[model samples]
Target: MPVGEWDAVLVGGGVMSATLAVLLAEVRPDWRIAVLERLDDAGQESSAGWNNAGTGHAGLCEFNYTPQRPDGTVDPAGAVRVAEQFAASLVFWGRLVERGVLGPPEAFVRSVPHVGLGQGTDGVAYLRARFEALRGHPLFADLEFSDDPGVLASWLPLVLAGRTDGEPVAATRAAQGTDVDYGVLTRRLLAALRERGGEVRLRTEVTSLRRRDGRWELAVRDRASGGRRRLRARWVFVGAGGGTLPLLQSARVPEVRRYGGFPISGRFLRTERPELVAAHRAKAYGSAAPGAPPISVPHLDLRVVDGRESLLFGPFAAFSPRFLTRGRRSDLARSVRLGNLPVLLASARDNRSLIAHLVRQVTAPPSTRMAALRRFVPTARDEDWTLVAAGQRVQVLKETGGRGTLVGFGTEVVTSAGGSLAGLLGASPGASTAVAAMLDVLAACFPAQADEWRPRLAGLVPPPTPEEVARARRVLGLAPVRPAVAP
Candidate 1:
């Protein structure tokens, strides 16, 4: 083999890249690796805790993960997969904390109850079915559900405020859920990787990628020093969050053909009242109203940052020309490649519902948003909360049968058959399941090394199987069966 510049080059400094770098370093300690980040520091983008809901998306409180069919049947597959992935991440993060790689575990992750709240008879039925379907899953053994208003009140009293004195409601909760500060985790993991002699080049941007003699040649620019450089790597991973699409197009990999991104920006309402904040102790998620987009499903989350308990709600999705919140205005226009035109067209044709939802969102005034908020907290006063910009999520769009098709959720990993380059596309149930997602990337990109890497991964992720779920329940002291149906 002719001398390659490095063993691997990671394209971003977010959770995905940092996690991959750590995995590669642990397995191939002698290999040279470099991380190129466009920003001045790591974890400043969507992975930042403040930029996201930080729910640790376990399918625990998120009802959108388990949608009901037209025939009234519910599929628990999506919920189970998300729950299993989050379980694996907790085990992995725990091991890293034990190894001193992530110092002061509280800085990055904290345990908090996850609750799902809903109203009326129809909503109660959905919650009951969702609860039943998930209660038996090995990964969801700790779930609890109740229809009593008293039980619902205990979970979140404000949810029932100013309601008809006899109105009925329902709630389901799980103690195993968490709120993860992914940015903090990213910084800590990257610190350990650096300690192991791995190089992370901040403020370095990749201008282009080309295959030269079966190796990846990346043209890089040092953002701070105005210096240009070239790096040749045996493999390249593009973990650029929303920037991945553009980079993949530059590679002309063909696997990314007919793909386009639809940008959705989220906003939240936060309360500063200490008294109200103290009353709220868990993340309470609710079902989206009829015809509401899945991304617009409202939730009231209790967020603890820097040891302060603050309440956050909403994540109302709006249209944006920029792929990232900090991205350039040219993002949407520049990503339209010849190969992706069909995908773009197909997406618009298939997602009339999402388009209508976006229209209502954009044309609606601030008062409209306040009205939506009132559904979750009837007593919630507009004067008590302020609107805060959440983050930008670039949903994936692709061509299907000569038309563009829009997918609201699920993540796609696109890499050429050669496995020299790969990029992650889409969002949702993100950040919370970084470990499993990265593991899938490694499994796809490196098949031959998987058997050897499995043990190392298992040590970090505990048991990634049903059998381990039992052991985890015992060791973690979690309930074995939905915790006696909550009151």
Candidate 2:
């Protein structure tokens, strides 16, 4: 077989590409690999710690993962699957630590409690059900739930402070939940991959992709020098966050030809106030406004970026034309094409409430956001928090049955059936599930080498044997649950 120009070329320096690059480095160390990033550096866009909530997203506190049914029954399948997938990521990170590929674990992940909290009759019922649904799962063995004010006060004093009303309130906690700085983690993984001799090209943008003799020829340009070049690779991956859709479209990949993006910009009320920040420790998640997207569910998160702890609340969703934080303002318009016109128009007609929620979020004054924050921190002072722009998330829209469908609230890996190209789209449960997501890409694209690669992957994210799962839990600082011995 003729050796291709390069073994693999990965676009985007964010979590997805970094993750796949690291995995491929371990699986195919001898293959030539390159990671090209459009930004001046990696981790500046959606991967930035401040740009996201930084929640580990293990379904520990994100109630949206477990939805209630029409008959008042709650489904735990989504929550359980998410927890299992996130555990795979923990296992991968733990192996990296044991192998000394990464520095101190705290540099990227920090243990913070994950709490699901609610008030009133409906809120209390939901929390109780959500807590019960997850209690039996080994992954959530350390979970706890309560309705007592004293119990809640200890777990979350800020939310309960100065509230004397006998209004019913309920909460659940998983002590081992984490806050992960994807920005830091992304840079760390890339560094390790670099140390292993993988090449990383920064400030280089891929303008187009063309297929030539079963390989991909990427048209690249150096943003600073205004120089253009072409790079050839056996395989190409578009993991450029919101930019993935356009690049996939440019590639003319039939798999992603009709896909479009609906850009959602998130803003948070952030506070570094010692008093306010110190009062909250857990990431508190609450229900979303009726008809709002699940990703917009309210949450007050404890974020640790660059070792400084702060609080972030209320992702007041708004509309934006740009797919990325630094992308051109005309990005949304550029994405509109004949292929996705009907689907785009259909989504508009079907999701009126979602569109309305976004509009209300944008028009709502600062005071309205402050009011939303007050739901989590009853005594939160407006003076204590500052409204700050977070990041851009472009949710994927696809045409199915000749109508547009909102695919999901999490990431989707789009790949060619033949396995030469792959792109990731959607948002939520994003970086926290990078390991599992990349594993999917590998399984899809590397079918030829999969039999050989499986054992290597198993070494890292081993089968969930009793001992194996416990080991991964221990690495995350979670207490290992011992199987009960017959008395």
Candidate 3:
């Protein structure tokens, strides 16, 4: 059993836990912090480069963020919020790089243009409205939109090749976009935490957590040795990705009683062919199908992982009983309880479209998936691409306004027990906004110290003003955002 209690204990070795660990270490250098991971190393789960799209999800290209309103206008609020959050992440990482905590930025993050494509007359009109809505914001001032085939071909040659349907298409491009290898970044952050006297225990699974005598007592098991031990901490953060819900339930947290988790796994079609990869230098996203979940929004991305570049497309949704990819097959069955049964049932009743969408995707054949990819890249050859399993995403289900709602890819921070324990739920725009999300956790969990910590936190992660955004981009080796041209 581990003896002295820790000031903070962060569960999960993904980017979320790594970011919070580093932030706590920076803000309170005297506090003892520890990170626990079931995996042999950090970021092997959702944070891994191959498990996710690797986009710096700044709302630059993802169309789902800017939904069209009933008035035939596009709402830019969500897009701006995501853009701001991503900018905060850039500032945090940029500062860390300058302090020599992280190595060269290009090793983990690289410049990749972001584009939003809209096909057909209605699609093009909606995209034009979206462009007009976001082009005036300081964050999106450099956004460019055009319906001309020549401009789109110049932007996405691979998508334009072999296309002859003559369907009208338009796209919006943001030059200052990025692709990040979060697995590398997570490892780097954890390494920095260790250098600052923080402890990281790998291959240690936290089996359960109990609140006793004003502190958290955790029972952890050693995967390799079959040894069990007990550890204590003043504060506990469950950033376990899909594994978060079960841990919170085990702790008997009343706040989680009404919550349920719906596990959705994904598959991506990837091609390492140099010619195809060379033709697509951007992460190009399109709208989701009518009955699909937000995670089904199709995108063709140029992914840079471990200094190698490849093109990936189609996050074809697959049904999974396990919350985490490596989790137990009975995880879903075990999670159901009398408390959340109603929530789960109601969610099912309310989200039949999403459920049906998952059914179709799970049964979809390889030929169908390839055909879906051809929507983005008309010239994509089946021989050049292979299907690879992506990370499992556990969408949150909870009652909102007297109805059970199945939340999409947006993330939520849930705190309980007078803020002593906190957990992160939901997915998408996850790692890219981790710094900001952790900052929120800090503020919520430690309201007393927030005022004092504000100055220090600000210094570490300043607000993303135009100047700060440019500075971070410069330090991160991303291209400068050119001024927006008149639409």
Whose lDDT is greatest here? 3
Q: Write down the lDDT of every candidate, Cα atoms only.
A: 0.81, 0.85, 0.92
Task: Give the top-scoring candidate (TM-score).
Answer: 3
Worst 10 residues of 3 by lDDT: 1-10
Q: Please write out the lDDT profile of model 3 over residues 257-344, one tens digit for every residue.
A: 9999989998999999999998999999999999887789999999988888999898999888999999999999989989999999
User: Which of 1 and 3 is the better model by lDDT?
Assistant: 3
Candidates sorted by TM-score, best first: 3, 2, 1
Mind giving the per-residue lDDT tens digits that candidate 1 earns over 1-487?
Answer: 3543888999989998998888788877888888889888899889887788888898988888898878766788888888888878776776676677778877877767889886778788888888888887766767899876677777777776677755568888888777778888898889989988889989998878898898899988888998998899988999988888888888887887678888889888898699788777788898886777677889888887666678898988777789777788998999998878767777777777778888888888989888888887888888999988887888888866666765567777777747878788888778888888888888889989989987877776776665564454344433343444433
For model 2, how many clashes?
Answer: 0
Runs of candidate 1 exceeding 4 Å displacement: 1-4, 70-73, 165-167, 401-403, 465-482, 485-487
The number of clashing residue pairs in each candidate reads 7, 0, 0
lDDT tens string, model 2, 254-306? 88777878899999999999888888998999999899988888999888999
Model 3 accuracy (lDDT, Cα): 0.92
2 or 3, greater by lDDT: 3
Runs of candidate 3 exceeding 4 Å displacement = none
